[model samples]
Target: MVDFQEFCKHLPFGLLIVNYKGEIIYKSQICENLLNNSDPNIKHIQDILPDSSIIKVIKEGKFDISPYKLKEEMYLIQIALEPGKLGGILFIPEGVIQDIINASPRVLELKHELESIMNLSGELVTISDSNGIILRVNNACEQIVGVKEHDLIGKSVYEMEKSGVITSSSTKYVLEKKQKVTMKQTTKSGRRLMVDGYPIFNNDGSLNKVINISKDVTEISILKKRLEETKNLLDYYQKELYVFQKSEQEIVYQSKAMEKLYDLACRIADVDATIFLHGETGVGKEVLARTIHNLSNRKDAPFIKVNCGAIPESIMESELFGYSKGTFTGGHKEGKKGLALAAHKGTLFLDEIGELPLNLQAKLLQLLQEKQFTPLGSTSPVQVDVRFITATNRNLEEMVREGSFREDLYYRLYVIPIAVPSLAERKEDIPFLINYFAEKYSHKYNHYKTFHPEVIQLFVDHKWKGNVRELQNTVERLILTVPSSQIEMHHLPDKLINTKTKVRGNMNLKQAMEQFEKQILIQTLETSATMREASKKLGVDASTITRKVKKYGINIAKLQFLL
Candidate 1:
């Protein structure tokens, strides 16, 4: 039989023999090479391997195994008692430790349990190396990533991304960032996925592996898109409904000019700026101001209207700013809340703003700028929150030049000036207005009536100097005074009918003749059923009548109702 030392030398491991006192008695040449020392006699085992388990093995006299590191290499240190129980023998085997552990029953059972748990998870899980090479994937990979485990395993993430298997790779980002990463990705099968990647690091703080988990968000994404579309459609229909309601309840017009003006008003209704309305005496500026107030955030609050021209100069200040008790003999016992205070947190419409007294403009300016005012016979300033909407038919700039208006107040009110179009400017809306007023007053006076085509034609041809007010007043008069159900030409005021034949003194004979010819054509078209009939009645060709109608800019559609 070979001796112990010679036998240990031929073994595929380093060997050492320590006595009961923990001193090394024998060591193989392999052990000397591993420890980097040739002499070992009389040296304690602790001196060679400071963290060794030789002393415990000697005391127990049992076989044991542990992991040990010498320099950068790892070894499995197996310790056992020597013969006669005098010492302990240590076997340091190079490599093959992992193979031994994997072959063990307990380790194999634990590995199978971990793999089962990973496979049963609902989220898609994948393990890849630092180089983006896929190592393992769970069963959820097929449902989420649209790829089977066998197809994805052992493949490079970079290669799969280039082939359109996935839109992007979270593992690649994890390797680059050396930390956790999350991102949205799309698969070749049109699945949207939210993926999270966790990186595993080595003992030296280097990236070792990346574990990725993904969730399917395809249905959620589609639902989110559909919800956005539905919300947009609802907003569009809501705006249309609002416009329809406004047209019925307030201002009525079918002209493009009015449409554009109302669109601008609605757009700026929410803003808290001082608006100045400029128009003729009866172009409906007050109505527009009220519409703005109704559309604003303060619709629930009070809307106070003050006609600056209607208030007497002697009592204007007291009426607008209120007066303390006993300020005058005729005053009420208690102090009063003025119109400005009554309009708190709401709108204050100042019609005929140009008619405001020159001295009072300064106080009005103070209220507008500071939102506070001094009541009559009171020393304290009363606070208010009022939105000012001023309207005037007179030229404010001319008044400013004439020293009748304050320049500062003009600028403050001129912040947002809207020029309301006159009825003559938007003549296309006249017919609709006439019909609306006719129906309105006929119901009011309990008389069901209509207007003859000739009467409507004369009304359209007449210039309405007072704008909508004049037209509305004329319609109301016709509905009330006319006894017949159909209002005829004789019922109209002479001024309106005379407009058809009245010639300005400034016109030459040829101009007057052309005007006369235009009137004749209009009258004939109103009586005839067609252009051919009108031409026959006038002794001219139908083409010549058509050319003359075009030259005169006649609206034949308006006359179609008569035919």
Candidate 2:
């Protein structure tokens, strides 16, 4: 006389039981809600679950479980066995299984976002279940793995590796070690691949899935071979002829934006037309100008650079065109040749050209047109053969429209315009730039160091207002200040570690004010030791600060320790 209905009443999942005669005996409260029926004895269990395997289990006197669909709803049917007899059948709804297996909404959203990112990524991406069954593959996999995504989706990585579909599998290693693994993989077509596998886990610490990212290093291998072949020959000649000249620091980058800029610069390097470079301050404008000069035919000749704003207005003309022996007091008595003359047969780079005075613009225009300029206190013009390269952080066209810059000069220098991208625009280059700066500074300071991966990730996500220069300076500072070999997050400057979120595009006044307030609160908390101190620093009461902190879910303990 067992009360089967009361037996599974408190379980989170629904449960139903039927006697071996196929008549419904008991149903849990959850099942009543799920099946939308309260009466279990009104009909035979066969009518409710017509295709259930419970009937077969009962007839064969064996326990069984199978999926049963009723009116577009799925349920699990489990048949129980009593001592020497068939017992009853139990039913559990599909929704209960989903709650046990599927992730939360936010987690699912993040997973979807990760998948989207992988889909758009340049590297080959493959994701597989814990058992090495491929679940998804990015478009890049089709080319690198030499198989269509659809063909690989449901296949096992072990079987694929055994069949030589892929030369190797990082997923297998990750599963074996239960951790991230990185190794070199070779393709059937003999392409060298750099593969990294990351293992994901469920909340209960069980294996979830494995994500594999691979890059084809075929071109890199070829370049390494070529370098090996040429290094000795170049070194011998450089030493024998005493022709070794220090090469300027090359632009460190691996981004598509930089690639486009490099290609554009190369295309126009041989041409002698005036080139104008435009970008934000510290975006490597001068480096690009130097790159152009070095790539040109006049690389061996003197390359003179002038900052128009740095020269006094009274001596600007004298500095550019040279002053005669007595043209001005305190001038070089030898009547030194100005940058224009000094750069003859080479290149002259004019930085901050937008800051040039109005009177000097006319002279600059004449020099461009006549290819000659009259020195101060001289009657005759001095002929010159110099290519002109101008750079400006300011908007020259806007200045021309506003009448501060000459329209003719603007047009003359705008022959070939190149725009250098900001650090934020080319975030992919952050890691390379960080590594370069870290190596340079580490060598200079006689200290070997490396950055924590999380620190590097923060640098990549930061909005570098000062562009490449700011990133380089930050890296140098970290190398010098960090006491340990590994630069951790705590070693970074407070400003960098607690940087406010950059507001992009446009926003309404209320939204702007909210962001500003949030930034202020964060800054105050970061610098202050306690809630009262933060409140006083921010010109607010302690209660107000506490209220706002709770609203924003700010981590007060971490903020207090940041200082």
* Candidate 2 off by > 4 Å: 1-248, 500-563
Model 1 is weakest, by summed lDDT over 10 consecutive residues, at: 83-92
**lDDT (10s digit) by residue, model 2, range 1-563:** 76655668767666656666766666677766766777635667667666666656666767765666644455575656652334565555577666745667877887788878997868999899999999988888777877888989999999898988777789999999999999998877677899999999999999999999898988899999999879756644533232112123446765668878876876677699999999999999998888777766788998899999899998899889986768767777778678899999999999999999999999999888889999998888899998999999999988999999999889999999999999989776777688888888888899889987656666876789999999888888888888899997678877766752232234444554555456556655755667787777668898999898887788877664432
Best candidate according to lDDT: 1
In model 2, which range of ten residues has the least summed lDDT?
A: 239-248
Which TM-score value belongs to model 1? 0.57
Residue 309 Cα positional deviation in candidate 2, in Å, after optimal superposition: 1.9
What lDDT would each prediction earn against the true structure? Answer: 0.82, 0.79
